[model samples]
Target: MAKLRPNLTDVDPVWNRIRKEAQDAMRNEPLIAGLVHSSLLHHATLERAMGYRISMKLASAEMSEQLLREICDEAFDSEPMLGQAVRADLAAIFERDPACHRLLQPVLYFKGFQAIESYRVGHWLWQQGRKDLAYFFQMRISEAFGVDIHPAAKIGRGIMIDHAHSIVIGETAVVGDNVSMLHSVTLGGTGKDDDDRHPKIADGVLIGAGAKVLGNIRVGHCSRVAAGSVVLSDVPPCKTVAGVPAKIVGEAGCDQPSLSMDQLLRATGE
Candidate 1:
């Protein structure tokens, strides 16, 4: 087992908590001691650890782990907000997902969190006018994680993608902060237009599993989209929408539907 470091409360409480969890994990499961130490305790900061983790996951025969690690380190170092987003994403998973018992779980195991972090790095590359490199990151992330997010897509912080299988966010899509979506959700275009042709999901929205919000539409803030719904038009704020051609069935049932992670659709009267 890796020796526990001194309390890092004064430096970074979140990173400190994750390191503590990692040490406990190593003690509980000696089989993963090397994995935990190499992945967590080996780094001095969360950014360094994330760079190592993302590179390990995305590296392939086409790209060496060392090169990918360099790219990830550059992204994390060049942009401080990336680190902030990482912390917020960790908090989101821990607070919302029942399966997430510790902060270390998302860092060491969850594909959703890993995919999102990889997307953020690709987005940074895109913004730096390195489109081809960004595309490379996108391809590797999709191939590795089964989640496809265009590097040009504008996604805000504190986002949680549960299950994260077959998720497709188009280039023009804009996702707001604190939004949560389940597996197989697609923010895609209708294939008719060439520009600005994807969905704009507002803050605090809860999109259920297999939901498809197609076209250049807006899903308003604090709304709930029921499972398997096919939304083709704009949805108003604080409303619950369901059906193949989704409609406003009722209220969102709470102020922050994403935070609650509640998918049950109560009757309008009930």
Candidate 2:
């Protein structure tokens, strides 16, 4: 029941023709259904659709299906853990946010997911010597999503950014695995020096609300940056940092192994 926006609905006749024809042709196809049935693949297609609509709205025809396909393949391969984490986080966010209607409304309407996913594509495009094209696409996503993430920043897997309003990631910023950040988190620069001049967040780091992490600091693994902390320097592993220019305040989150399906199978010897 999800719709392609009203403004773009004018083209629905053409798109519907093509989509139905394709679906009809693939109705009995085995492999085609395999791809289409995957929840992850569907999520990706939806994101590409979002990117396309945003591009058209901005009057930029630069977003091609070929380019989007390249972005989707590359991004999907590059960040499996990140993608899983992001999806899981978004599901939880949807469950909690009373504003979301439990349907796919948030996915279609929420700019946060759309912008971030497109930025992943933008980053791929940038690395492939398409800087100008990448920038144009980024602008389109920004205009649509109200969220900005520079393509040059490095991010790891399973990054869940919920209600990600005003989130900014600097060019040199590096985020490690399983990092979750709430609204208004900034990984930014301090001065004019371009030499590794941004923050490096290690694995399993949870950045709280309105936290600003600046400079070339390293926030260690399994750490939590408390709400409203303006971090300026390095934080030790297994610790919590808080307050202005954030300093260590409490113990880190407990480290426990998350048992995988294979692990459970081995435990049961089935």
Query: For this target, which candidate reaches the highest lDDT against the unseen true structure?
Result: 1
> Could you tell me which 10 consecutive residues in candidate 2 have the lowest summed lDDT?
257-266
Model 1: weakest 10-residue lDDT segment is 1-10
Per-residue lDDT of model 2, residues 194-235, tens digit only: 888999999777787799999999998877778799999998
Top-TM-score structure, candidate number: 1
Q: How many residue pairs clash in each candidate?
A: 0, 3
Q: How many backbone clashes does candidate 2 have?
A: 3
How many times do residue backbones clash in model 1?
Answer: 0
Residue-level error in angstroms, candidate 2, position 149 = 1.3
What does candidate 1's lDDT look like per residue over 61-99, in tens digits?
899999999898888878889989999999999999999
Candidate 2's C-alpha runs over 4 A off are 1-106, 256-270
**Candidate 1 structure, TM-score to reference:** 0.96
Clashing pairs in 2: 81-158, 82-157, 82-158
